[model samples]
Structures are given as structure tokens and as C-alpha cells.
Target: MLKKTDCCQGVVNRKDKDGNTALHRAAAKNYPQMLKLLLACKADKNVTNQAGLTALDVARGQVNNRESINILGVCSFAGVSTLYKLWQLIVKILTEASTEIFQDMDGISSDDRNALLVILGLLLTATYQAILSPPGGVWQGAVFIVAFFLTLGLLKPFPRGFKTALQVLLAFFAICFQASIYPIIPFYFYVPLVINIFIFLVFVIMMSMCTASRVSKISVMVLGCWLLVGVIYQSFASFGS
Candidate 1:
């Protein structure tokens, strides 16, 4: 019924009681309508009052916070469900986008891809056995978290083809991660969960190598080389022994 903009502007331009403007009142009352109007009228939303609070800042001080609370209710925070959904979507998109084998950053095509694939597959294979045997809920949750983080690490700016292979691995891992967390409470229900988690991590590493968008790629590469050297050295040592 009231035009808050004009009213707020009138106070902003000057001459108000107690040196407080309409913006002050709007903030105190948590009056979104009035505040918006005042802001549109050049009411200096950033201007602080004698108490050092801006319109938005003052709005936050309203203790009962009836209006602000209502506003917040309309905006939900991102949660595990949201992340999982996004992860699934990313996996699907990647799967649809690529058809090529991912080459390493170097001239080398992934000699490591095979090893990672084997590790991941075996982990998944072991997971089902664990799950049916006992409730290992905590283990399952832990596995899921590890898989999820690994997935994040895997997502890269690499071309679509390479991404797709990684995505297949991503989806597989995500499924396993979620699977482990199933029957959610009482922490004793996820013996199979750990296996799934292991599957996810193994492949995620493979994916990370192929999709090294991060600055840390050099370090990872160096570490991989060192491991390779260590393996060769160990083999030679065993032969000599």
C-alpha cells in the first residue's frame, strides 16, 4: 500500500528526526519491502547509522528475525544430497562426451591406467562380500567420503574423451560410496562399504593423473616417477638376492 522507495529517498536526501532515516526503520523492522524501496531510491544501503550498522547489517540485528528468517527458509544450503546429485550428473555428462583413451601429460599414454583399473575393480568385487557379511556402517560412510573427495580430485579440464573414461570410474565409485552408506545408522552396517570406497579411490587416482588441471600435477608426476624407480630397484634387488 505504501511506496517505500519515495519515502526512503525523502529521508536519504536529508532532514530526519534523531538523525535516523527511513532505512534505519526498515532495517529495525526487517521490512524487506521498505528496505528494497529505500535502496532503489539511493538510500545508501551501505551507509552505517550512529550505531555503525548498514541497512542490511541492521536487518540482521532484529532478534526475533521473523522476516529475515522467512527469507532464509526460501534459500536452502547445499548438502550431501545436492553434491551427490551433481556428482551423478557430472559422471553422466563425461560418459556421454568422450570416447578416447586418456594419454598422460607426457608423451606417454597411461601405462598406469591398467594398474588403477585393476585395483578399483578388485575393491568393488570385495565390497559386496563385505556388505553381506556384516554391518559396517561407519566404515561405509568413511569409504563414501573418501570416494567423494577423490571424485572431486578427478574432475579436470582435460578434453571430453579422457574425462569420459574418468567419469565411468567416477560413477562406479559414487555408486559404491553411496551403497556403503546404505541402511544409514548404527554404524555397524557397512562391511562392504570399504571395498566400494577402495574401488573409487583406485580409479579416481587414475582419473586424476589423466586429468591434472591442478597446479599440483608436477608434484604428483614426480612422486609417480619415484615410485616407478622404486619398483624397478626393488625388482633388481630381489633378483640379485
Candidate 2:
């Protein structure tokens, strides 16, 4: 009906009594085809509903039909998923190198280990919250997911005495993983994601090699610092664009 000149020009962009436009209803109803048609007819997607949610916001809140979210293309779900897999691989590498890369297990006293465990727990909590309700949204959640998994991986090398703590952390990590996968994201977010993943993998490998006595530890540390700085610069640049 949107093809009809009167409908297209008159009420296609009209909001209901609740302030939801045709585009908002299309998104909320998970009708991607209808959404495309309405958008083609120049329906206003940015119109806020009674709750101040745009069509894109409504799409993100949809639990089952994510194609609607994908059609909207505001969140970075694709980039975040790719980063999630990449971080899993990085965690596996870190796990294998834990013995050599982490501080010697024997050197950490009970008090120190407990303190480290507490710190990791706090970091996990913060990352989980950040990912679920990100500040900058989109790519910000992607960054927090990286930090979440990295911290979780770091928690793996602790003594068996902390097995209970490890289990609790894993449970929350799984929840965070679930929350991060819901958004349907755009393609450009990959710029920052790829940069972060490449740098992290390099950082891990360099740490392992240096600890294996294959390279100068100080040299690896310096290189890691510089690479981290470069990644930060590139990530911000790409994300802003």
C-alpha cells in the first residue's frame, strides 16, 4: 500500500497515538520486508516511540527475529561474534603457554593469589556489565568482550585450590558470551576488531617466546608496549569513522 501515492505521501510516516511510526511497528514486529518497503517509501526510522526507542532500538530488543536487527544495522553483532571466536582461539593459545607466560605458580603466596583472584573477579564483573550495557555501544561492547575473555583466560593458571572460583568465573563468562551474541552488527566494525585481535595474538606469542628463552624479554616487552599503543590509536580511528 505504500506504493500508492496518497498513502506514501500522507500516512506512511505518521505515528500512532503511542508515537510509534510505521517503521517502528515494522521493526518491533520483526518484519524486515515490511521495514525495507517502508524505508523505500521514506518512512522515518528515527522517530521515537513513547519510550523514546527508535526503530533500530526496537529491533535490538527483539529476542527471536534478528534479521530485523540486521536490517537496521546499528549494532556490531557480526564484528563482536568474529572477535569472540578470535578471542577464544587466543585464550587457547594463552592456556597452553600459561606455565611459561604467567608468573611462576610457586612464587605466588596464598595472600597474593587471593588478591589476584579478587582483582580478576572484579574485572570480570565490570566487563560483563560493560558488554551488556556498553557506554559507546557497538564497538565498545566488542572491546569489553575482548577484555572479558582475556581476563577469564588469565584466571586459568591459578592453583587448583581456586577451582571453585574458576567455576564461578566460567559461569558468568558464559552468560556474558550469551549477552554479547544478540546484536546484529554492521561490517565496518571489523576494522577495530581485527586490529585488536592481531595485536593480542602477537602479544601472546611474543610473551611465550620470550619466556621460553628464545627472545630477549625486555625487547618483547618494548615491542608489546608499542604494538598496544598502535592498536589503541588505530582502534579509535577506525571506530570513530
Candidate 3:
């Protein structure tokens, strides 16, 4: 039918009311043969629907449809632009969820707030000790220590100037830590380093946005501890080598 008429050129790109083109419908339905036919007809694979999701995104959301995902993966170029869009989507979702959570905190009882404060204090002490007596006794842990304290300050009711200063200082120390580790990271570890840097940046942004929230403060503390542990393990391995 497509070859007999101008349907391949006209109907292939035409979207329904939901903004899904022929390729989008085929991909969502996991119709590999139809998907191939549509692609052969020059269907646009990147056209987003009303939800601003591409065919690839729709395929991904179908967790049980591995065949569809694999088909879409073969057709799509895993380029930087795709990754950037995915990252933007993730940041948007996290920001919205955190903002909603923070906004709903007014109903918290005094007891719960006190409990959170106690937990934060314990985490602060643990982080301080980890800094003072770092794995392999390396002073590189100082960078993380600075970052931890700056993040801790965010949970407190500090002046606007002071809070802004802490945020800047925290970001600076986190970046410094990444830079310092880069020299020691092996060539094969380049990918891991990039991922670590990305996670650090995300953590910094989240901290900046939800500074006074208990959930954000606890998350930062836990992530800081986990990152420190990884750095320590890597340092020890390097020393052994």
C-alpha cells in the first residue's frame, strides 16, 4: 500500500491527535517489521509526542518490551544531544519532586524535626572523623571535608549571604577534589571519572536548591560518605600498585 501511493511520503510523517507518527506507533507496539517498513519509508524517529517524549523514550518506558527497545536503539544514534536531553529530563523530574517535598514540610511535628536534627549532627560528626583520619592517611580527604561542612551549613538557618557563600564553597571543593583525583586516575578509568564528576555536579545542584530540607541534607551526607569510600578504596589500590 505504501509503495502503491504517496502514503510513504505523506502519511508516514502525519501525526495523530496525540502527535505520534507512524514510527512512534510501530515502536510502541513492538512491531519490528512495521518499524522497519516505516524507517525504510523515511519516517522521523525523533518526533516527540504531546508528552515531549521521542519514540525511543516511549520504547524505554515499556519495560517488558525489550525487543522494541533494541529495535529503537539500533535506529537511533547514541549521540551527545540524546544524552543531554535525557539528563535534562532527569534533572527536571528530580527538581520538581524535591520542591514538592520541601513545600509539604510545614506539617512536620516538632519531635520529627528534632529527630532529624539529631541524625544530621551524628552524620556531621562521622564525616568530620572520616576527614581527620582518612583512608591511607592521605590529606586529599580535606577537600571532601570542606565540602561536607559547607553542605551541613545549608541545613541550618543561616543568613542569605552566608548560605550563598557556603554553596559556592561547596561546589568549589567538590570540583577541586575531582581535579586532584584526575591526575591519579588511570587512562582506563576515564569513563568512571566522567560519571563521578557528573554525579558530583548533580549533587551540588540538588544541595543548592533544597538547602534547608532534611531530606536533601541527609542525601548529601550519605552521598558524600559513599564518594569518600570510593576515593579511599581507589587510593589504597593505587598505593599497592
lDDT of 1 by residue, 1-241 (tens): 2233213333463525554567767767777776656555666444445665444555666787667434422323435334645754664454333222233323323555344445545565465445545654345444444434433333444454565565555455445444444444333324333433444454445434433332133333443444445435534544454
RMSD of 3: 15.4
Give each model's whole-structure lDDT: 0.47, 0.58, 0.58
**Per-residue C-alpha lDDT of model 2 across residues 74-167, encoded as one tens digit per residue:** 5433345346457546645654675454446446677776676577667656655665563424444445445443444344345433633553
1 against 3, candidate with superior TM-score: 3
Candidates sorted on lDDT, descending:
2, 3, 1
Model 2 stretches astray by more than 4 angstroms: 1-96, 138-175, 178-185, 189-241
Error of 3 at 89 (Å): 7.3
lDDT at position 91, candidate 3: 54
Candidate 3 residue-wise lDDT, 1-241, digit = tens: 6654323555687889998887788777878788778777767677677887777888887758787777667746656446756755775676666556455445556676567656654554554454445352224344444445434433444444554455555545554554454454454555455545655665655554553332234445655665666656655655565
RMSD of each candidate relative to the true structure: 19.5, 21.8, 15.4
TM-score of 3: 0.31
Return whichever of 1 and 3 wins on lDDT.
Answer: 3
**Number of clashing residue pairs, candidate 1:** 10
> What is the model-wide C-alpha lDDT for candidate 1?
0.47
Clashing pairs in 3: none
Model 3, position 24: C-alpha lDDT score = 81
